[model samples]
Target: MSPYTRPSIAPQVFVDADGQVIDYGHRWSDSPPTEAYSVTVHPERYAPLHAVAAALIDHLRLTYDVEVDEGAHVVADLLVAPSWDVPRAVRVRPRDPKCAALTFVFTAFPGVIVHAGLLHDFPYPLCGCDACDTTWQREADELEEHVFAVVSGNYSESVERRDGEPAAWYQVRFANGSSGGSSSISTVAPERLEAAAVTLPDLPSGWRPWPLRHAAEA
Candidate 1:
């Protein structure tokens, strides 16, 4: 939790005529293998990131017999000031301390190294507009939503995954007994959503588990 008061203003999005975005800043990870969920966010996003960390733990508790790390703040903003030193990153831990960490790097990319197998680097392009933000947010939203779905097998009435196959992927059997699967799953993806969340790999790029094709409100 971020107890420190923060500035009302946030880092503004700037895209030059060439379609390149301004380099706000960069963060370097010692590349530590901390068995936790960590997100490298801009200073402005500290609060929301903190909330998400707690929510993940809560979600896990519902479906699985879970044990979270002993801590007051599961999601912590490294810093959240308004001046020279602001939040460079946020961290979330929702499982056993012995498990591998899942690191999300949502920041500038220069001089950053993400060699750790568990870490994911989301570098903001040098030239981008508001669209980039929307895309990134959408990606984050999809990740969280699908992760929970796959973990709880809640995307459909019942689910079964065939991950041991050459092209690893999961299949969803809807309440109507109709099932669908990924068109192409390059390499081997995680068999369980819990593994997927921790590794956060590039596979299973299009799970398409949203907008409710099974049933829509409208």
Candidate 2:
């Protein structure tokens, strides 16, 4: 979004008596301005640095269709902290009260947005019912099994009953080279294992499952 026409504020820079740079930083306003938002640009690297800052604001406006007030300002600042790993922070104020104002802080890397904190307060419906939890758990289990099979190169599976009970338990055997045969077994239960078997896909190499320990075993 186009920023409001406000007076530009120069970032403070500190240097030693020998002309060595000590600190280069900008301080954010303690209170929100009378307008919507503000922009700060670093004095030493204003041109290219402010371009990056302006592009980020434009992205939020175009992508999210957000409105910018005519009186707000944009500040481009220097990386004063020892760590340059800070993410760009954007604060949005929507005119509608029902729509909550949001602050999005995210690291902008090539082809990825890392450590994003966008939807922490976004209004999204969430279900914690047993049925919903069970369904989600089953899907996750199936995904884990598929990854395990691909990594271990073992697709052999079977369902069997113990002590004349229903055949609701299933086991997958993996080939262990040290044993000179397939003997490593992974077990799953509760009848949903059959459904996973039916939907199993032929996996390729280089896929691995996260080491997961069952709570019952714990």
Candidate 3:
């Protein structure tokens, strides 16, 4: 499936200097004057984009406590030009009069090139604002509430085994009784179903594995 086909969701992103994403439901604004340094990955090197993006994000989080949006488009601020060359580095100067200019650099070895001094500071603190805190809490609360909802039966589920596979697939019915959503749940042994069930979300949620799908399953 194409990466852009999914429903609208918050990007797995860390806002530049604000320490918080723009907003959960809003789009990242590129209104302010900004500069972006991007590298066009040769088609042969395309497979590494995921790892490159991930490494960049990890570097930001580990070194600067900055988080990029999870959505591929949003993470690289490529919404308008979704197919724009993958951004290896991005710098934003928010239109807000109070914000400061910030830069981000992403690099991976063996093929990905590292821009010198691309990251303004090797280690920096995430933005600490009431808005940031509230955004963080909102995401956390939504997740916790959804998990409880699923475990409490606000959502119902059906299990079916694929014809050729040993795994069972799960179809979840939301609290509102909506259908059309499903996932593979074959990896959770029967013994651990209960424990796994408690972690699944029943609400409209993000990309996180709800109902506890094992990583190995992916």
Model 1 spans with C-alpha error above 4 angstroms: 1-12, 17-55, 58-64, 69-134, 155-165, 172-218
Candidate 1 per-residue lDDT over residues 1-218, each given as its tens digit: 21212223333565545877634322113332343124233334323433343354444434343333432232121111112222233332334332223222233221111111122222222122222222333333434543444343333211224555333233433444533444233322344334555443433332222121112211
Better of 2 and 3 by lDDT: 3
lDDT of 3 by residue, 73-134 (tens): 33232111222244455543323212222333333321222111111122111222322232
The true-versus-predicted C-alpha distance at residue 82 of model 2, in Å, is: 26
Query: Which ranking of candidates, highest TM-score first?
Result: 1, 3, 2
State model 2's lDDT: 0.28
- The reply for model 2, stretches above 4 Å from the true place, is 1-15, 21-53, 72-96, 102-218
- Lowest lDDT 10-residue stretch of candidate 2: 110-119
Which prediction has the highest lDDT against the true structure?
1
When sorted by lDDT, best at the front, the candidate numbers are: 1, 3, 2
lDDT against the true structure, each candidate = 0.31, 0.28, 0.31
Winning model by TM-score: 1
Assess candidate 1 and give its lDDT.
0.31
